[model samples]
Target: MASSNQQVPYGYEPPQSNVRGTLIYYDDFNDITDAALEQAAIVAEQMRFAKLVLYPLHEQTVRRISNEQVAPFYKREQRLQEWKLDSGRKSILVEGWDGKRKKYTPIEAAIRTCMDHYSSPYFLLMTPEMANRFASFATFEEWITKISLVLTRQPDHLHPRMETFRSRWRVAGEQRDKNGKQSEL
Candidate 1:
């Protein structure tokens, strides 16, 4: 008789079949080896994927614009009106200021207002390289403070996907801390 510790290749059904001709496992399903589990985890990590979806901040009704439709307008440095899918109509673009062609002025004012309202420091991913460099920080809060300081001086460097990147990092750091505590316990 084979010992319980003997390695069993996956899909190695015993030389028996059910009445329906389906191979049935005789061993306990929960007896997966640690190596097998680790291999599965590695494969999953290799295939892992993520996507960022952006929604309007306060608008209840909004439209989805395809990349192709928006690309030309963006390339030409022209303002495009947001489309409303529910009503099948285009919404008027609201200009924050009159006759000003500055790019960062509006964004800076908005960021300052938000910072004043929150009265707390926050983080921005800024760039892919910056996000990757954040791993060297001692803690997530420290990283946030550093990024907030940079934003206070130069808010124009803020990345378009900063919120998504921040969320991913925050969740990952929380999970790491939880695992550490569990291991200690």
Candidate 2:
């Protein structure tokens, strides 16, 4: 939907035709359509029950999504480049490279050094009726012990269109997936 001529101070007022004879229902932050919002809502509900509703936001999340949700043997293959980090906290950085991939070039490991040490079990108290559970055991050995490897992989045989869904949605699309979908509601 194009912005209406009825411009307001902050931004353009949404055109009535785009809104379909309004009774203002709800709008997301950037003001995408209701159908988009509904699809998003459904995705969010699915994520709350699980995590599939949301797209991966971080580099590790990208790797995790690949391994658990899409690729079989994918470790977080993309590494982070060198930066002093926004916070002064010095983390044990681990560098790995993929000659074929582009993105975070060298991985900056979080403060938790899996190579040399493990985390102590830490807990979070979110609510009275419901709570969050996280396990922290020192060393990759313990962490790997508690985690189960997912059996899914990026099948080499999906239709070409299927390739888009496996990528990170946070950035501009350069892959087949980004140029593939129009995202209509």
Candidate 3:
């Protein structure tokens, strides 16, 4: 039989996506593996070929655009508009990373910051290279990869510090996936 440890997941979809086309979400960077973008690309491709159903989250709701001086007692009703789906379509968030600067930002924010309306259909970047080229990583995989690389590069005398690098996620890909189902924190 093939060694069980030899197998690994080539790609994985993130756990959440309450938005379509523009939603880039993350549980922060979990040390840069670029898993987020990979998932988004796959979903976006599926959406392109099919008449994917639109969710309420994607619909336009009334907005008070400006409240600079107009609101004395008036407040916006930002309710729990939970994103619902009919089980056919899946959504993912995409983002960008700046390798040289060693930072990442939401693609929407980056576009708005440059005052450019141009943006990509995808939003959640999973790989560092992809994130840098794209716009942002909804989750930071770099930190994840960073910590991993650090542990791997540690000096011989620093084994204790290496234990901190050891994470329960280090199990073979399949087991790790199952274990990851629990709360991240």
- Winning model by TM-score: 1
**Model 1, 130: alpha-carbon shift in Å?**
6.3
For candidate 3, write residues 1-185 as lDDT tens digits: 77566555777656775333342222222232334334433444533322111111111111111112211111111111111122224432122222122333343344343223223332322223222322223333434332221111113332332234345212111112344342211
Which pairs of residues clash in candidate 1, taking residues 3 or more apart in a chain or in different chains?
Answer: none
lDDT order, best first, reads: 3, 1, 2
Q: What's the lDDT of the predicted structure labeled candidate 1?
A: 0.26
On residues 28-100, what C-alpha lDDT tens digit does candidate 1 reach at each position?
Answer: 1122344432332232223231211111111111012111221221211122112112222221122222113
Sliding window of 10 residues with minimal summed lDDT for model 3: 54-63
Ranking by TM-score: 1, 3, 2
Better of 2 and 3 by TM-score: 3
- Candidate 2 on 61-113: residue-level lDDT in tens? 33432322322112222211121132122322222222233332221232122
Q: What's the number of clashes in each of the models? A: 0, 8, 28
- Model 1 misplaced regions, further than 4 Å: 1-110, 117-143, 146-176, 179-185
Error of 1 at 148 (Å): 7.3
Please give each candidate's TM-score: 0.21, 0.16, 0.19
List runs of model 2 lying over 4 Å from the truth.
1-79, 95-116, 122-185
Alpha-carbon RMSD to native, per candidate:
22.3, 20.1, 19.7
